[model samples]
Every structure is written in structure tokens, then in C-alpha cells.
Target chain A: MSSFLVPFLFFSLLVSSVFSDQAAFSSHLLPRPLILEYPENSVETLQTQLRQFDADELTLQCTSWRVAGEANNLNPWKTIPDECLEYVRGYVNGKGYLVDLQRVADEAVAYAKGLQLQGDGKDVWVFDIDETLLSNLPYYKDHGYGAEVFNPVDFDMWVDKATAPALEASLKLYQQLLDMGFKIILLTGRSEAQRAVTEQNLRSAGFQSWDRLILRATEDHGKLAATYKSEKRDEMLEAGYRILGNSGDQWSDLLGWPMSTRSFKLPNPMYYIS
Target chain B: MSSFLVPFLFFSLLVSSVFSDQAAFSSHLLPRPLILEYPENSVETLQTQLRQFDADELTLQCTSWRVAGEANNLNPWKTIPDECLEYVRGYVNGKGYLVDLQRVADEAVAYAKGLQLQGDGKDVWVFDIDETLLSNLPYYKDHGYGAEVFNPVDFDMWVDKATAPALEASLKLYQQLLDMGFKIILLTGRSEAQRAVTEQNLRSAGFQSWDRLILRATEDHGKLAATYKSEKRDEMLEAGYRILGNSGDQWSDLLGWPMSTRSFKLPNPMYYIS
Candidate 1:
């Protein structure tokens, strides 16, 4: 009787270990390509299923997160989390993207030279912040959801709390252009009142050199026609800039006239346009 | 003989006064609108006369000048004297054109709000700094004749040496928008390397907030494809900004897609775009 009991106990332990291993594998598994099987005459159903699957993947990979101190919160960005960063780098590089720090710097320098050639008082370049020149990834990661939207009040606090490390390559490139004699104009959508904090951030990030830092005017009292960019361009042209180039991470930055030399796009797949 | 001499002296003084007045007027006066009169049979003559007149005006107003007090003798932004500023303002106002500063600010804010509503991570507001935000008239006045074409290298030095004073109304308005949470981006044709001095100028002028400050990439490489402002808008859009608005003194700022929320054109008659 004693021998039979020992054998049974051993078998039970083995089973438990197998189950635990399965659970772990399921929880931590990375994403994989999905396959779908559909019945005949189910085109709509299949399409819907595929879309939902894609959305699920996106949510799982891009949106799933926890704030600091939350259970299972591993600080994705900081961890460089094995597969994620590699995936990002691969994706960017695969696209023939030039995140090559030197290349970015060189591009900036070249653009500045073009502006010099234009050499008009009206010529100027406007830049967008937040991913254009600085990386706010860590901050977002720490904060957990990207859905809260950018609240200026909160943003000012966040920027003040956060320290943006210069995108070394982009920064050097910018500095080189400055040395080449281009007037640096910082046009941003940040509220005009956060000037102090914003300026502090730029300085801290080593972007202390700029000709004019123009923020959104808070005193507008009109129909809000959505043509402010064109107006600003007009103002710049009126001021005498041939406007050799303009740069930003958004389509709006490149929308207005005279066109920009080249619009460089930075990666920000975490968010979507409204 | 005495009577004749007295008359001669009076005539000489009159002639001297006329010449003196003409000289003073030339220095301070805005160019008067010229109407060409051609014989009915000579359309070609009319065209030639018009072209010559336009050329003359362009030469007088847009001529490039050697930058003063710089090692490289770089070109700096041309100075539009106070008199010129006043004249330009008058000319535009007389033509029933309003700068519409408040309207511009409001439109920009609305556009930004729209983008935020869309959940876009990108934000941008491309601006022409000089006449749009700060007044460079004083700099021009102080430097005299040799301050016409924009010289990136010299301008950087000047920005470093000079203190920027906020254009009172514009600053207040800009600050208000910043407090509302817009990302301020400054795009200029200025060289990239002068980032430091540009920041100094912005801070001194009370434009202390910004997200990204992009200058013209002025190195040996070829010029950017889009003109500065358009490229900036494209960058903004690519980054996912809905592009709230753009403000500038010229039409070039408004030439591209995803149009801004009602462009604000500042009065600038000292120069014109082709």
C-alpha cells in the first residue's frame, strides 16, 4: 500500500508542473501571424474577422500598458523589451528609413545651406516639437494610456518634470545648420503661456539656439477658420523670407505655400490622427 | 545789383529747401504707386515700362547687403526701418487689409483642438517670426543700409549679441495659446547651427516656449524639395497633426495642402513675392 501511494503522488506532481509551464507560455508569448478559415459565401464575415484580428494585434502590441506601479507594468520603453525595440528598429530600417544619426545631422546641415542660398529676409523654417526633435516615449510609457489626450495644463507639468535628451543625431544636424547661418524659428502648437517651461525644456535638451519661438496665439476671437498656417506663411513672406524650407512631424506643417525643401518624418506609431 | 542778388539768394534757398525735402522724403517715404501711360498702339512699350518699373522696385527693396561686424561677413536679415514699417502698415490698411492678429490666433487654436480631438500625437504651428511675432525694425534701423538679405551666420551672432523684446500684443496672445497646450514649432530658413543664439534671442524677446525649433539644413548637400513652409506642413501632417493654423506675412506660407485655419497676413508692403 505505501509503494502504490508514492507512485501516485509522483504522477500528480508531474501533471501540475506541465500545466504551469503551459500557462506561462500562453501569457508571455509574442504576437504571431494569424490564419483565418471561413465558410463559402462568408466574405463579409471574413472581412470583419480579419479587421478585428488586426485591431486586436494592434491593441495588444501598441496600446496595452499599465501605469507605473501597476501590476505587470514592466516599463516597456525603458526595458527596451527585447522584441519591441528590435521590432521597431527593424521596421524603421526595413522601410529604408535613415535614423542613422549622422545622416539626420547631415540632412539638417544641407537644408541650412539651401536656406542660405535663398538668403531672403522672409525665408525661415518652422519646426514642431514632441517627437520631431525630442522623444517623449518614456514619459508616455510611464503614464500608461495614450488616450488621455494632450492636456496643456498636464503637458506643462509633464514637460517640467521630464527631461528630454537631445535626439543626438537630429540635434547635431540642427546645430550644424545653425552654424551655417540659418535663422532658427521654433513654431509650435503649445500654448503661449507655457513659454517658460517650454524654453527650459529646449535649453535642457541642448536646443537653446533659435531665432524666434512662436507659439499659438491665445487671444484669437474669430470664426476659427483653420487657416492659421497659411496666415503665418503669409506673414513670413511679408517679412521677407523666401522660406527655403519648413519641417515638422505632421502634414499640417508642410501644407502651406512655397513648399519646404524636404519634410523629414520621425516615427510615432503610438498615436493616431483624429 | 543788390535787388538782383537778393532775388538770387531767395531762389537758391528755395531750390536748396526743395532738394533737402526730396532727399528726406526719399529716405523715409514709401514708394508711391505708379500708373504707366502708353500710347494706344504700343502694348509692348507698356509691358516693357511696367517690367522696368517692377524691376527697379525690386532692386531697391530686395537688394542683398553684406553683413556687418561678422568674421565671415555673412548676410543678415534686411532691415525694414521704422519708417518703412509705418509706411507698409499704412499701405495695407489703406487697401482695406487687416492684419487680423486675433482671428489668426483663434483659428490656430481651433485647428489644434481639432487635432487633439482626433487623438493625433503630432502638433505643429509654423510661423514666420520676424514681422509675425517680433519686430526686427529696430535691428534694421540700428544697422542702416547693409542689413537687407538674411545672413544666417551674421544673424546668429546678432541674435546672440542682441536682446529680443516681445512684440507686446503678439506675445500676450502667443502666451495664452501656449497655456492652452499647443506645441509651438518654429520653422525658418535660418541655418541649423545657430540654435543656441536663436534660443537666446527668443528667450530675451519673451517667446520662451517651444516644442521643436528647426532651422534650414544648410550644408553642402542639395536643397530640400519642398520650400521650407510647405515641407514643415507636410512633416506636421506626416506626424499626424491636423494642422490647426499657420501665420505669416506672405502667400507662400499658405500654398500647400491640409490648408490652415484662415491664414493671417501681416501688413508688409516693403517687399513683394513674385
Candidate 2:
């Protein structure tokens, strides 16, 4: 090589080494999982249980819970009498809880409006499934019944069999938003594996008129276990919904919007932080 | 098999088929690349020529340019010239033009305050690399780069040689934020391949005081790119950033905040989108 070429080559090698090292470190810190396990229990059951317990008590108990471990103290295997589970489920699944429902609905409505087309004048709303539009109360309630630890396989099975009755007030509000020419987008954390059952449940519950139904990408295992809501939110933002408002029971769903933008939170007191 | 087993088998087969179809469809639709490309020459001398244009005009033109393939009636390739290339390089490498430096510094200060131990009050700011804390203008401008096409080899070479002077203002802002008990965070989008160079570049730029320098995970092909930001944002939020403001050039970076947050956008008039 020429004398000048030697220096160039050396610099190139240095740069290449630097590039490789940075890439390696990043991967080390942000390792992507090959499979994402969706905990079987629904947010609804957790919400109901939270209602049953005092907030201060739960917070204290949670403080003792180790956030990272093979054991999840959040869902202890303690059997609740079937009668009690059924009663709580009924109250949670039924209507007349409009105050909380309206708060969430109002948020969703506001999000939908914010996403309304700028000059097109068309309105649209995108909703996420797991902890957003519907509650997974039955699955978790079953967990309480059997007093079992959270399991992905069992959760998938439950989702297939699960009947999602809308958080009544949310349904009415969503319908109202749809009626006003706002396009309804049903985005969910449910994997492509549960797409059919999920869509079936939505249709059965009268959520069939949505403009689009997006299920989580199966290949996105790295994100499945965490941050799924944000990924879906990006898709919604990309689709240009002037999101006037968004409603979800999870903090992740509402964090992406501009300040004072409408985001309604339903009570999901059962479990905190996915 | 027994009669009961036969019915169970049939049901499983039915369910499996339904799931398979949905998975196939979703995989086909949702995994598209988010960035687009401009003509090879479009970005050629942009930095140099851009010096004559006001920041607002530069930003408007940058965002308004059609992707290479979608340029409607305009020919981006026809605009390049050798003389203007250095000028473009100057702007791409100069630190004098960023308008959001102070804003980023202010936001970082609030974030640090939130994360401090009651009286510790040390400040820190975490920033994403691509389109966030640094401008990749020269790399693309040198190659007249376009988004639809990703040339990893050439891209890597450019990144290796890339110097980020525009970021000086942002870095200075980071320093100010740090002076108020805040630390700096150098988050990036470059995969594992660019790790060493990224770190060296940061260090070279006098950004040795960062709290963390997180990088993108490479194992899952960045399927969770959107989620990565949210997860990090949540961590910051949990850390108690009082007025934790995030700065990024992409919408994905700002997706999940609950408050009316502040964010500063450094112009990337070249070509990028989440």
C-alpha cells in the first residue's frame, strides 16, 4: 500500500473497531427476547381486586414485592370463593360505573379528536386491547380461583375462550365517537395468534365497524413483553388520526400524547405496572 | 384415539388454522421499513446550500421534499454540485445553528432534579443519537442519500467518518443541565455495528459525563425500536424527573408522556421519519 494508504487503512480500522464496540454494548444492554410471554390474567380482574383492597395496603404489599424474579407476588395463588369472584366480575363487567367510564371515555374522545384529520375534517380513534379498551378480568379472576401463578400458555388459551364485554360506558362513548364520523381503530397487544378470537369477540360485542383491527406483530418478540402499547401508538400517529383523545387503563397508552390532550384511565387497581 | 380425544383434536385443528391465517396477514402488513429515501444527489450539497436559507425555510424544504421515488415532478438528483458539498458539510458539522439547545438543557435540568435523592440534586439528561442529539446530515449529504434504500456498508463507512459539530450547542446545553445537578445520557439508534464509533465520537465531543449511553438492541433486528424508547422513557419517568422533558427529532421518541411535555427538534432537513 502507498504511505498515505497506510494511514487511511489504520484510521479505517480504528473507526471500524469503534463502530463494532458501540454496537456490541448496545445489544448487551438491550437484549431482545425471542419469545414474549403474555401473562394470562386480564387487567379487569386486577382492577376488581384493587377495589376490594385498600390502596395503601396494596401499595405497601407491592413495595415488598421484588419486581424482577421467577416468582410474581402480584398474582399469589390464593383461591377466592367462586361466588365472590363471580360477584366482583359481575360488577366490573356490568354498566352504571359511568363516572370512571366517562373519565376514560372522555379521554378517549379527546384523543380521537386530537387525531382528527387536520384539513380533511375526518375524525379517527385508535384503541389498544389488553389494558386499554377491554378488561382481562375473567382470566385473572380464574387465576384467583385456582390460586395459580401467571402462565403464558394458559393465558393464550383463556384469551381464545374469553368473552370481552365492553366497559359499558366506554362502549357507548366509542360508539358515539364512531357515529360522529370518527374512524375507529382497534389496536391490540393480542398476538397474531389470538387475532381471530379477538376479532370475533369484538364483532360479537358490536365493535365491528372499526376502520382497522391491528394485532401485535408476532416477530416483535423483543417488544411484546414491554412497550407494546407505544409501538401501537406510533402506528396510530403515523396513520394521521388527529387523535382528539385516547382511553386506556394503562399509563403507557396515554404517555405519547401532547400535554392536556385527553387521555382517560379506567380503574385497573388489580395489578400495577405491566 | 378415544371419541373424546377425536373431538378435541378437531377443535384444535380449527383454531390453529384460524390463527395461522391471521398471523400470515399481520406479518405481511405491519413489518415495513419506516424510513424513506431521496435521490442520490438530493442531499449532495444541501448542507452547504442550506447556509443561505433561513432555518425555517430549510426545515420546511427538508420536511417537504418527496422521497426519491415519490418526488412527484421534481428531480432531486439534478440539484447536486461539488462546490456546494463542503458548505453542506460545514452546516452538517457546525455547532452554531441548533435552536433548541437551551430548551434541551432546561428539560434535562428538570429531569435530573426528579431523579435526585431528596437533597442529592445532581442533574442528568438522556438523549437519543440519531436525529436527537446529533445530525447525520453530512453522511447522507456526502452520498446524496435516500431513505427507501439502506446501504449498510456505505452507511457504516459514513458513520465512521462522521463528526457531529452541530451537536456542540446541544452538548453545551447538556453541560448547563449537568451543572444544575443533571447528568448526560447519549442514547442512539445505530445498531451494535456502530457501537465503538458512537462511543468514541461521544467521548471526542467532550460528552464524557453521561449517566448512561444506551444503544439499540441488535438481536431482534430492532423489531422493538418503538418500544425501546418507551421503556427508557418509563424508566426516566419512574426515576422522578420533575418536568422531565425529552428531546428527539422523531415522533416515536415523544410517544408516551403523560404531561404536556417540552421537546426540542434539531432540523434534519435531510430525510428521516419514524
Candidate 3:
């Protein structure tokens, strides 16, 4: 071998050991190239990889934006930042997303298990629909994972198909709650007009049944999600259904007066609602 | 060379390329080996590495515990779970914490910049001291990043040192807010007796002055942070100050009635106040 090649080969020998170890040690939080989206060129790929490795300013900023929303520190946000599309894409499609989802589910179940139910059959678990029970990832998979401005018309078109799948972690939680004898209430911002398809989608997705699948009425239009959900929760209260727990992706679904006894907010780094 | 060595050598060639590109791409969120703690045995290291690699259940659960606290989903948590010591260590000592801190600071600044100031100088910004402005991380660093249950006597001894450093991002934000003509209020759960040391520490940490440093009086003892802070905020209003913005590391510091126009919560995965 050439003199220069000797040291180069020695260095190569060292790094291969590290690579061999990663396979055994890879955590789901680590990025996996599971998406079959057409690959970008080497330059773009290298730049993106380097950016993530360095934990660049913009990457942290984007993460902060998403996390801030989750923490309810940042409210009334519109779309994910234009620069953070790929970050959001990788996050939503990656194992990190599942880890977050499963984490909330585990905690929620633990919380449920600890409850000494009054057993009046009025104990209800409130869940938001989209991104809580059913996922619209099939639609979002094409829509830039919320980098694009939300198009309600296009989203409604996707909803019309009623093909969204259950969030696997949430599905398990839903079933577990049912077995625990808590009544289920699906309080969603989805319009009442979508009730037929939404119900069809819910049943097909293994949700089985809910005592009440509350959706927005015509009068509920133009109200903020927080305001609308608050009113619905009030009605649930008046109906003698004790809201023992509430689960949703948006803080709006979790907050407001007459809140749940415990609220489990699952991860949704994609988008925000008021 | 032996035939077996030939394939192994070729594999090494491919792996080294991945490591070289990592330096450029390192983000603040990536784990960094900054702490000088001695390394564990290879077997233990490998076991941990493997667990994190699969995004194993326990790792995700611990992350959930921490994230749930940030989301206010988990309340009144006691300490970092025994199973998640290393995860908490890695996160607190790693780049992720700084990324979280800097992100909050940046967003807080953005929000501050947009305010149409009344120019009354009575518009005050309320700040939680520990973990919000001054970082007690040096203490927590030795305390297993909260794996150990909190020891008030030990913690108080550390606080009495009056040597805690300013969170760099918060320090910058403080300077900028002062420059922008906003009155500063330092509200903390620290006691009235510790005022001397607290003020000294604040000055030493680049916090020059505050319109008010509202620490707990003897009568304020036994009240929860939310209650105490709320009452104090009411006092601020009574004293003719407009709380334009509030920032903290705990929800207790942000919640309660008479909230600020905007509340900025910095990240604190190590502990939860309420």
C-alpha cells in the first residue's frame, strides 16, 4: 500500500468498529431511513446530516417551537417554520414519534390504573379525534408533515375517504380504558357534518364504541378550538358524566375551565391549533 | 492478509466515512461527553448502549416522565425515576438542555420585541429565579440530575454559597429587556431571610437590579408556589405595575389567575415544582 494509504486504512479499521456497535445499540430515537421518498443529492443529504449532527441554531429553534407548543408555552402558532419541514418530517415519521406516543399512553394507563372508580358508569375518558385516536399521516405524508400551510379543503377531502388509521399506542389505551369500565367520549373539533364518516372511520380503526362522539355543530363554527371544546366539556359535565381523564394532541383540548381530572397530551410535533 | 481480514477491512472502509461527517453536523441536541465522570466497565456500557439503541421501553418511559412534566401532564412528581438516571444525566448534561434553554430565550426575545410598549416604565416582566434566570445546575450536576430526592438542608447550603451562575441565554434576555425599558421583577420561592444571599447571587450572576425581588415572607410559608406567586402578582397590579410578560421553568410559576399577557417557560427536565 502507498505510505498515505497505510494510515488511512488504519483509521478506517477503527471507525468500522464503531459502526458495528451501532446496530446493537441503535435506539429508536436515532434516525432511520424508513421513508421511501426519493433521495436528495449527496450535497443536500450531507448538509442536512451535518446540520443535525451539530445541533445547529435553526434546528434547536425549530425543536423549541414544537416543544414550546407541547409545553403550552407557545400558543396560537400557525404552521411549522419553513426551514423546519425536513426536521418535522423526520420527527413525525421516525421512531422518536412512536416513543413519544407510547410514553404518553403508558403514563395515561398508569394514571387510569391508580384511579378508584366511583363505578357509577359515569366516569368518562375524553379523547380528541384527529391525531389522537385516528392519524391522518397518510395525508400528511404527502403534505410536508405540516410545513405547508394547512389546507382545510384538501384535509377535508382526505377526511371524506374515512381511511385514517388508529394511532396504535392510543388504540391500546382506548381498549384498556374500555376494559377498565370507563365510558369513552370522543370530543373532537371535527365538524358535525363529518360525523358519519368520522364514526365509520373510528369503528374501522378499532375504537369499537364511544358513549358520545361530540363534534362541532353549525353554531360552534368560528369559535376558537379552546372555546368550543370547553363548551362541549361543560355539556359532558351537565350530563352527569364525570370526566376522569382527557387525552389530546392540542393543549386547547386539554385546557380551559371545567378541565379533566387528569389530562394526557400525546405528542404531535406536526401542527398546532388554538 | 487472511481471507477473513479482507472482508473486515473492506467494511471498515465504509464505516469511517460516517464518523468523519458527524463533527460538522453536531447539534446542541446531540449528546456530548462534557462531564469528566469516569467511564464504566465495557459490559455495562454496552448494555446501556443496547437499551438506548432500540429506543427501549424503559428509556421511552423515562423520557415520557420528563416530557410529561414539561407538558404539565404529570404533576407533583418526586424525583427522576431510578431506572432513568443515566438518561436524565445524559439529557441534563448534554446539548439538549442548552438547546431547550436557548430556544426559550430566543422565543421570549421575539415576543418581547413585538410588544407595543406603553412607555410607562410600569410594564414589568416577572421572572422565576432558580432554573429560569440563575441556574443551580452546578448543584444538580452533582445531585444525579435529580435522581436523588431533594434535600432541603443540602440544597439550602448550596444556595447560601450564593455562587450559582446565570443561565447564559437568560442573562442575555435580561440585558435586552432592561435595555428595552421594561421594569424587571424577580419573583422566587426563596424565603425572605435569604434575601441578602439571593441578591448577592443575582448581582454576581449579572442580574444587576430588579424593580422588585418578591421572595417568600414568613407568613407566605406553606403556600404553594402558584398561590404565593398569584398573590404577589396581584400585589404588583395593586402597586400599579402591568405584568407584560412572565417566564419560568415551572407551570406553577406560569399558571393561576391573572396570568401575564404572555408566559415563557424555560425547560427544566430535572425537576418539577408542582
Candidate 4:
């Protein structure tokens, strides 16, 4: 090799080594990933608070929960202050809430049409008694609009009087469901002792017929509200009932296994049940 | 009571009876509250799905989460498809996202300045690692933008590369915290084994110093992300660290106990861990 070529080759080698070393050096400077043991003191465990929403905000939230079938109980929201009760009333009585319900009901009705209601005693419709079929406006008005703690003694006395009125919108849907040959089944959280008054209330409220009115037995008191309702629906399914549609105010009423083909939710921000 | 005459008394008796009967009748027609036993099948307990939001909507949702510390996770959001990742990018890289961060940081700085930074070593600021201070954009660029299931192996390799860049805004805020004599503590969900790499990464990425860097332990693998993170913060509080401020990408990082006086959330629609 020529002397000039040897010098050039050595210079090129030097530059290449320097460039590679610089690249490696920079890479080495980068932070490596760390694996840490869970700190012993790190588990003080904070209690996460439920996100808060003001009354006006809650109207949209509750509406969303209702339509989605994961509604809170009929009771007032815990985070919302007492001053917001009037706003809750505004939402329940307002056109927007009603329109949304009508839309959901309309969708359920359309879905029911697709089912073959041959009346093999197989096509069943599940209905929640409170808020779904009956209106408790008078009771809540006299009470604290669901903000007050429930008094079973007072409420049962009201039930004993048995003068509850039918929810007008739900009544129309009920009659339509029956006319379409869907056997109606009523599931309620009311105690079994209230059966006589409840049955009387339903009849007087214009619910002319229903295949079954299932009430909670004394033994089922300790279970979750969702658990009891789900059992009844499951029993019906086991007995060869195909629940074409279900409607309720609380999510616990509608969610669970063996779900109906479609579920409709009505606006009820008055309470929540787990 | 019988002053008016026997006949008048008889009329009054009749009127009273009629009124009582009418009251009873009216009561029956009023809406009755139903008591439903919880459903049995209802316990098939579905994991509640997160609500959906479009790309434009997510920008707002993320902004809200950042400011308000309430956010929905990415899964089960039907509207956010894989293709709309560009929107996520737009929000994270855009002026709006940065502007919001700057606003939050400015508030924190103003807040910190007011605080008595007495160097008691108790006045400390907590920070979360990923997304809070460093941008994992390069890794997530190749991986699903938080839409796909997490593969630890792939993620670990990325961490090993230690190529993450410091989030410029966060770095600035971090320096401000240090300048104010606030002890800097980093708490992250990354495993303990990756400490060296992580430390190097932080330094290379422009984090000059911090008092402590905490990572999760192997035993904490199964614990809830929120629970684990919260416990850690609680410990810090017990040890005399007054957490004046905090910032993180996920709600888990901000929500735990011994909460900082204020928390700033960074936009991360990329994923959610609770």
C-alpha cells in the first residue's frame, strides 16, 4: 500500500472508533428501568371518594345511568347537597327526561316486535313495581323527596292505605305489552307481608292483569338488592320463561345474568339500591 | 260534641265515614314503593364498561380529568377506535393540552410560593413517573397507543432502551419545585428491578435530582393499582412528609390517601389503571 493510503486508512479507523464509542457512551448515560419492592409504608390505603356532581350535572349523569341500565338507587345522590332537591324534581318532571324514557320504551317496543310472541307461555316481560309501574310522587312529596332516611313503618302504613296511582307512561307501555301477548311478571322489593295491599294497589292503579307478582320472602332480606331481583328473573328463565324485555328504575333491577333481550330504564333519581 | 241535635249528629257521622273511605280509596291509587329482593342472577356482576367519547370528545374528557382528577378508562369506550389515535396525538402535542398543563403548573407555583418552605424536610412534592414527567411516545408509537393489551416484555425492552424524553412542561415545573426547596419524591408503578435504568433515564432525560424514587415490589403485583399507590402516599404522610402537591397521568396516582394539598393530572387517554 502507498504511504498516503496507509495514513488515510488510520485516520478513518480513528474516526470510526470515536463515533462508535460516542454512541455507546451516550446510550450508557440513559437511565435504566427500575424494579422496586412494594414499599412497606406505601400501603396506607386511601379511601377513594365517589366523584361529585352538582344537581344540574347529576341530571345528565342520572339520565345517562338510567338509559344505560346502571342507575343509582331511588334515593338522592350522596354527593349532591340537600339544596339540590328542587333541581332533581326539575329533571324528573322535565321534558328531556321524559323524552329519553319514551325513546328507550319505543326502542324496547320495536325490539319486542321482532320476538315471536306465540304465547307458548314462554314470552315473559319483567316489570319492576316501584317507579316502573307506580308513581310515589305523593309519598315523596310528603316525605323528604328521598333525601330523608326511609321509615318502613310510615311507608308500610302508606302502602296499607293502598292508593298508589299508576305511572301514566309505564301503564301505556304495560297495556301495549299485554296486547302483544307478552305475559307480564312483576318483581318488587316490597316485603312479602305487603302482598295483599300491593295486589290491591296494582289492580286499583289500572294494571288489569299480570301473570305473577313476586315479592321478597322474609329469608331473602340479607342479600343484596341486585341478588334478590336476579334470582326471581333466573327462576322464571328456569321455568321456561323467555324474558323478552325488562324495565326498572335502578340498575340492580335490570342487570344480572340471564338478562332479558332488552331492558328499559325510567328516570328515578329519588333513590339508589346496591 | 252533640250540641246541634240528633239529626245533625247523624249527618256529621255520615260525612266523616265518607271522607275516611275516600281517603283510603285515594291512597290505593297512589304509587306504591316496591321492595325488591336483590336479584340472584344479577350477581353475574358484569364489569361496568367505561362510557364512550369521540376523538373531539376525548380531548375535552382528558382535559377534564387533568383538571378535575376524574377520568374514565380507555376500554369499553366504543367510540374511540384504533384509527382515531391521531386525535390523541393532536391533543397531547397540541397547544390546548400544553396550555392546560401550564395553567395548572402556574397555579401550583403560585400555591407553592405561598407555602412556608421552612426546609423542615417535611414540605415535599410528589410526582408520578410515566406520562407525568417523561413522554413514552416513542414506545407507544410502535405499540398500540394504549388501546391494546399491555405486553410487559415489549414494554420492558423499551424501558431498557431508556429513550424516553422528559416532558418539557413537567421538567420545568419539577425544577421550579426544587428551586423552591421542596423535596422531590417520585412514586411509580414500575418494578423495583429497573431502578438503575430508571435513574439513568431520568438523569439523561434532564431530571437533575430527587430525594427518593419508589417502585412497586413483587408482592404488590396483585394489589389494586390505586390501593398500592395510595398506601405509599399514606406512608409518606406518616413519616412527616407534607405532600403539598402531586401530579400524575392516571387517577390511581392522584387518588390515594395522604393526598397532596393539590393534585394536577396530565392527559393520558392512552390507558387507565385503577
For this target, which candidate reaches the highest TM-score against the unseen true structure?
A: 3
Leading candidate by lDDT: 3
The alpha-carbon RMSD values of the candidates against the true structure, listed in the order shown, are: 33.9, 28.3, 10.7, 26.2
Of models 1 and 4, which has the larger lDDT? Answer: 4
Per-residue lDDT of model 4, residues B1-274, tens digit only? 0011112322333333335444343333224321122133322211110111122234333322222112221122322345545545554555434544554565567777778877888888989999888888788777667656667899999998887999888899899899989999999988899888899999999998999999888887788777888888889888988888888877578764656776666656566677
Model 1 CA deviation exceeding 4 Å by range: A1-106, A111-122, A145-152, A220-226, A272-274, B1-274
Tens-place lDDT per residue, model 1, B155-175, is 456666646555554676578
Cα lDDT, model 3, residue B119 = 87
> Which of 2 and 4 is ahead in lDDT?
4
C-alpha lDDT (0 to 100) for residue B8 of candidate 1 = 31
Model 2 C-alpha lDDT per residue in residues A181-219, reported as the tens digit of each score: 766677565688787898887777666677777776766
Local distance difference test, each candidate: 0.47, 0.47, 0.77, 0.63
Q: TM-score (0 to 1) for chain A, all models?
A: 0.57, 0.57, 0.80, 0.71
Give the range where candidate 1 chain B is weakest over 10 consecutive residues by summed lDDT: B64-73
Please identify model 2 stretches exceeding 4 Å from their true place. Answer: A1-98, A106-122, A145-149, A224-226, A256-261, A272-274, B1-122, B125-274
Alpha carbon lDDT at B274, candidate 2: 42
* Root mean square deviation (Cα) for candidate 2: 28.3
Error of 2 at B212 (Å): 22
Displacement of residue A239 (Cα, Å) in model 4 is 1.1
Give one digit per residue, the lDDT tens place, for model 3 in A1-274: 1111223333333234334543342343134442222133334433533443333445445655667778876656677778877667766776557777887888899899999888898999999999999999999998888878899999999999999999999999999999999999899999999999999999899888888888899999999999999898898899888999999999889878678988888888778898
Global Cα lDDT for candidate 3: 0.77
